[model samples]
Target: MKQQSEMILIGGGLIGLSLAVELKLRGATVTVLSRNQQEAAGLVAAGMLAPQAEQIPSGPMLDLCLRSRALYNDWTRKLEEMTGLETGYWPCGILAPVYERPDCTTLPQTPETPSYWLERDAILHQQPGLGNDVVGGWWFPQDAQVDNRRGLIKTLQTAAQELGVTIIEGITVEKIVTSPDQKVTEVQTNQGIFRADHYILTTGAWSGELLSIPVYPRKGQMLSVRVPDDFKSLPLQQVLFGSNIYIVPRRDGLIVIGATSEPVGFTTGLTPQGVETLLSDAIRLYPILKEFPIQEFWWGFRPETPDLFPILGPSSWDNLTLAVGHYRNGILLAPVTAQLIANWVLNAQTDPLLHHFRSDRFQTLR
Candidate 1:
């Protein structure tokens, strides 16, 4: 019998955990190392699978987003089956209210997602909670969301555990050791040295520390507010996208409001200005939000690349593969990224899309 390929995954975020499960399902022996699972931004994301709502014009990133959004249904279903847990995968769609006519300009459209302009009356009829200040807006029926913090992570971690994938938490990988031939052979961590046949990096913002990648932290401050009992109407049933902020409603009566994009470089702190801007923008989208009590305030650093696109597939090192630099779309792109990486590792074949996300792109540009 052929020996199972042993793979070491650095970073147990949604991407790393999901990749571990995928590799295990493909008959590989996988071990995942996470410095701090709770610190992962994946747990804090509002989980908007809005390829059309957050369109990337026309490029490889758009292709990746749409493909991953298409897989959420099946992915969540399989996860639910394996873990018997609800992933809170909601296909309730997204509503982008146009507070001003200029906000509607350059509204994105995609062939796969069904999007249309809703008139002012139609907008109110669809989601009656919005403020009268809103005019018309774009509605994306194909867009969906999940509860990443509580729902998605629970299912993923449970599923991975049940699949016999080993996950070691609170273990920080200090550096990756490569052979003289430029092939990754082992990883040195705070806990100990671990050797594996293959090494996969999904360390998000910390990717630069392990490897000389251009990945950096793009800090985002977010808050969640609980729905009040005296509210006149039901909680928001769809995501609200306004000028520069978005309000995502949870099934459990909490609205997730976010975020401010600041390049603060690994620094952590919630600023008053950030929170105020979020509240101001959210209230402008729906005046009723003022009645809700603030439930949580937190921040996460998104792994950003120079081009703002993910660095996927093989890296410059022979046995090292990259699955980082997803920025704001990490949660949205987790499923397909896992599938593609697992497929490439198992088959040893190059995927055509790998060309677009190669980690050596910056070096080539130099």
Candidate 2:
């Protein structure tokens, strides 16, 4: 029997696996438990690190996203060297396209906030495939994406093994057994008993359901389609947004159309309504995409907290940590979350944002 662990991470998803790798690199003996065939939320994401584009105007989420965006280049390079996997990390930047409705009673806009405003003629010039009545947009040069599917799998499974971190899959953790001091002692699984000195949960949408996190699942159904042979003639130069819809194009000739946020807990299957909404809006935004053939269809859950941000940092337990509830931003935030968790573990300091996402925030709502 293993006596005790330097650390044990749960959920084998992006955050769990990334943190495990970081900890092991820092000399901690780490083990990651990944269970089920569930695509492990991060795997299904378009992996856009677009804080500047998705900026919520005001909140801790904006700051967290910016901090994470700042880390992408270095993080992707490190993962690539170790696993020889192309993370497809493109720093080509993102464009936040704006649509205007000709409102008669509206305040003047602020240009310093990084948004672009153009009339139909200019929009047609910039994006030849756009529909009529197009307005201008915002540009986020820092927003980028990783081929999250490849990145998560290679980073967690392949890179983790290369770094000597143990991965146990398909085993459900029944309970977290702890010492009298209330530190995480081990996790009991259906397969067997695995002991550890500390535990971190990165279970995504399953985080709250597993351990009463103030979290829930927000499902997004997305699809990928191949662009036309002449895709390059009027190809999208940046990630695009029209109204509430977003179209993300990859270098591999795959243009991804996504995604509607629905509150259906833990259900992976896509509904007719979900698919209709996404496809309809996608075609409306980029008329060229309508001619492309559909390549893949996917549905995933974003682990959302009440405040729509991740609940990270120390738990009430001496050695337990909360690194879940990242909701839609998990893929964007994974690397930075791993780095921050590693820093907290090494320095024993609590993140200031912990006050906002702490489990206690929900008791008041109840």
Candidate 3:
């Protein structure tokens, strides 16, 4: 029998864990090295699968987000079956409401997109929890969400481990050693040196520290609150988005409100201003938030790129691949990314989407 290829993945975040599971299912021996499994932004994210709502001015990212959103249903379902864990996959759609009329001016009008401009009466009829401040809203019926804490962090970890993928927590890769021909050979880590035939860098924000890449930390602060007993069953059935804040309702009677995007590098402090902004905006959208008890407050660094799009696919090194720089949409894009990276490693097939997210796309700009 031919020996299974050895794959060492650097970074145990959502992307890394998903890739590990995908590669392992393809019969490769995969191992994941992470600094600390608890610190990834994927855990802190609100897990909103809003593709049209998070659309950039214009780019391939929206298309990519939509593609991943389509795969989420099957992906989470399979993960649940494999690990027997509830991933908190909620297909309850998203509502992007604006307090002022100007906020609705930039809503996209793509022919194939399933968004509708909702008037005040229609918005209130659909969701009665809104405050009078909401003038209008954009409804994306296809967008969905998952509980990152349970669905992604715990679920992905459980699924990866069940698939025979070794997860080394609290380990750091100091350097990646490649052969003279630019093929990855081994990684020197805090624990020891580990060799593998293939290396995947899914280190997200800290990706630049290990590889020569442009990934940076975009800090985001978020908070969660417990829904009152009366609202526990339904507690805002859909995700509500305002100017800079978004409100996500979990199935377990907890509502997640977030987040402030600060360009401060790698700093993980929750500022008074950040918390104040999130609560104030959240309460503005739904007055009932003031009656709820605070659940949690935290922050995480989003792995961002210059173009605000993710970098996926192989790097210059033949045996190394780059799956970092997912930014705000990492949770939404994880499944598709895992599939593409695994396909490339197992069959050397390049998905068309990889062209838009190549690691070296910015070489011509310099």
Candidate 4:
């Protein structure tokens, strides 16, 4: 008989949903179980799709990012075609202003790209309210973003429904029960029994509670302020880069300012200090943002790995796969992750990305 076709995935966030979409497209039956809280986080994240603009220096992490960036165009197209969701994916560009002298240190100008290193006059012309004090900056027209909140939820719910993939809500996965041979036989859930041939854990920050994968919660605080309709220029067309913090604008006039990367041990609270820091920094970068009224103040935890990249592929166990600890790049890396995992589920040996991120790295941990 052919290999069993049912693939059960835990965590209904972008990663889980994207994987379901990929697998369903390839004719595999997929089921996604998402706890309410995990589903909500996807409804709140800022979906930045910039790898070159967001990659931090050098490492295996940067390589994963660049590869993911290359895959996004094709991935988004399929999702849009299948689900008919726009996904708000824009590859327009990113603007990194250099107002403070330290701004250059954070997001350095790429001399290779002449369009970067924008003069103050040009920045003002391109973005009218860019704090006239700015001197120069970098511009990346290829970096992109999506309205992550809408894109994720719509994709998950719609894709699952349209593609005949099952989505069970309010089902919190307890653990992956493995056999003596290191094969996952079943997933224990708060609701009931779920048996599967292959189990994937993509629970983000919560993955640590279920699996000892070295994934931790890195607290990130965000501010959503509602800008006035009559406000001067499009305060944000590109994901704005700045000295300390950055801003992302949505179609509904809600601009997001973020974030503080605090390892607060899974505490997702709304803090005054966090709010002040994001708001204050946003104004420093774009004086026009100061004119907006504050709307939402909140914080959440990002699933962080020591290597700052997701661990994919089969777990130490035979049938359990790990897909957590994406840290800051979860949204950016979702498309490629889905493709890689979907391939792993089918081919079992052809996924090079799987071998690259396996937990065997922990054996060399020092």
* Cα lDDT tens digits for candidate 4, 224-251: 8887867675557778877768788876
Candidate 2 residue runs with Cα over 4 Å from true position: 1-4, 101-115, 230-234, 351-355, 363-366
Candidate 3: minimum summed lDDT over ten consecutive residues — where? 103-112
Task: Summarize candidate 1's per-residue lDDT along 43-79 as a digit string, tens digits.
Answer: 6578898888875677788888898999999999999
Better of 1 and 4 by lDDT: 1
How accurate locally, in lDDT, is each candidate? 0.86, 0.75, 0.86, 0.74
Q: Rank all candidate structures by their TM-score, best first, as comma-separated numbers.
A: 3, 1, 2, 4
Error of 2 at 118 (Å): 3.7
lDDT of 2 by residue, 1-366 (tens): 343566778888888887888888789899888886356677567777777677565567776777777788888788888888787888767665555645532223334234454456665776677765456555555578777775555755677899999888897888877668768777787878787667888888877766766778788888888867864553876777667678887787777777788887777788899888988887777776778899888887878887776888877677888899888888888877888888887777666755666666667678
Candidate 1: residue 324 Cα off by (Å): 0.3
RMSD of each: 2.8, 3.0, 2.7, 3.5
Tell me the spans in candidate 4 whose CA falls farther than 4 Å from its real position: 1-5, 37-41, 99-115, 231-233
Off by over 4 Å in 1: 1-5, 102-111, 230-233
Query: Would you give me the overall lDDT of model 3?
Result: 0.86
Looking at model 3, residue 27 earns an lDDT score of 91
Model 2 — which ten-residue stretch has the worst lDDT? 104-113
Q: What is the TM-score of each candidate against the true structure?
A: 0.94, 0.90, 0.95, 0.89
RMSD (CA, angstroms), candidate 3: 2.7
